[model samples]
Target: MRKSRYIAKEVLSLFAILVIAPCFAAAQGSEQSDKEVKQMIQTQFERMYEKGIQNLSDRIVLTGGVKPFAVVSDTGDNVKAIRIRQAEEMPPEIALEVLRRSLIALVKKGKIGATAIFYTADNPNKKSNADKVLVVEMEHIFGPTLAQLVPFTIKNGKASYGEQVVVDMEKQIFNIKVDEESAE
Candidate 1:
């Protein structure tokens, strides 16, 4: 009877360990995944900011006032995208210029192979919901080339595309259409 009790206790201990091991491993796995995701997001944001500032320091400086920027990140099972949006109100032109410079800097650094930038220019009037959004798609050939452009007009929070603007950035010359896209 003593021998049976010893065997039964050993079996219960083994069973408890077997059941808890998986739970402990799963908890560790979750922590590791969280750390990896956070690192990836931080790395991406740092790359964008460092490359942008390094290449376009003169163009990206905030001169008029302090414009706060918010780093927005989205991650899912299949897709992830990060956006640096203006948190505080600023001139739409400045915001667009900053975004354009950052895009160019990223392209020059060979950071983006093929990417699309969807940017919004908020209305300064603050009277109506008439923000402008511009989509610039780029492709990597020998370098980043402006593959496509989709200009949109937002009225009452509705977006309507006007025309498709296409330009080859490799040519090193293109007319900036900020006025055409800004919320005027």
Candidate 2:
């Protein structure tokens, strides 16, 4: 009976190691993949910024009071030259701050969910690689409020700024035009 018990313990230990080893390997691989994706996003942002600035300078017409709304994505890419319509009476800085703060707050609230995909190195059932989605929520204060921002997507490690648009404060209604032409 003692011999049987000992054999049973050995079997269980072997099983535990077999199950745990793969998980540990997978976690390490995931961390490395995440780092790689972040680097790629940074590179993409740099390239986009250079292109966006030149484009904005060439084509954007800023009305006297209109300020360029810095379009920031979840991936930390800031696309410039977005003209936001503001009330001539309201301070431009205040208007810009309002829009920026709103976006930052929404992101931190996890309103935007983003994911990243990676190929698995040793799983046949899961295909060559798999996708890992990370929902990042930032908790910080810019001025008077706690701001939260989440990445929009895992493919580019960036957030999509599609829903947020600059509006005319004088109209009393949230009606605004998105500068889609210059956005891309």
Candidate 3:
């Protein structure tokens, strides 16, 4: 009876180790991956600063008496995640007014969720940072959403600005525009 009890204890111990070891290893790997991703994001921001993308480091203050709004996410991080650092909520009319003043467009109606200063890192699935592009995608909603993607790149320790990308949602196409300041 004692011998059987000892054998049972040994079997339980073995089972615990077999089950937990892989989980422990996987947790450690996940922590390492998170650290790597955070480091990559920091490096990309520094590169954007060097490239004279002033928007990356600048503090944007909205004019007039409007207060800032809370940020919200539309979806989960399936591909890449856009982080909104500052935002302001505006009614449809007020949003349209702001958009028109910024030369975006003139419209009568449609809710503008937020006027956001946001950015998204390039796909981290890439093996190296050299293949990455960090983008600031600002959207001002009038009657429709007008989105802009300002891409910044770093390679061989040199930082530079790429073409400004604009997507036409109605047409489901992207348009590249030259950033005059960066082009200089």
Model 1 RMSD to the real structure?
Answer: 21.0
Could you give candidate 3's per-residue lDDT for residues 1-184 as a string of tens digits?
1111222111112233335545754877767654543443333323322322333323222221222121211112111222222323555335433433332211112112123323334534354433434433333221123344444444444454445555543311112121222211
TM-score of candidate 2 against the unseen true structure? 0.32
lDDT, ranked from best to worst: 1, 3, 2
- Where does candidate 2 have its weakest 10-residue lDDT segment? 113-122
Model 1: weakest 10-residue lDDT segment is 1-10
How high is the CA lDDT of each candidate model? 0.36, 0.29, 0.31
Ranking by TM-score: 2, 1, 3
1-184 in candidate 2: lDDT tens per residue? 1111222111112233335545754877867654544444433333333333343332222321123233333322323333345622446446545544444443445322111111111112233222221111111111111111111222243222212122112211011222222221
TM-score of each model, paired residue for residue = 0.31, 0.32, 0.27
Q: Report clash pairs, candidate 3.
A: none
Error of 2 at 122 (Å): 55
TM-score of model 1 vs. true structure: 0.31
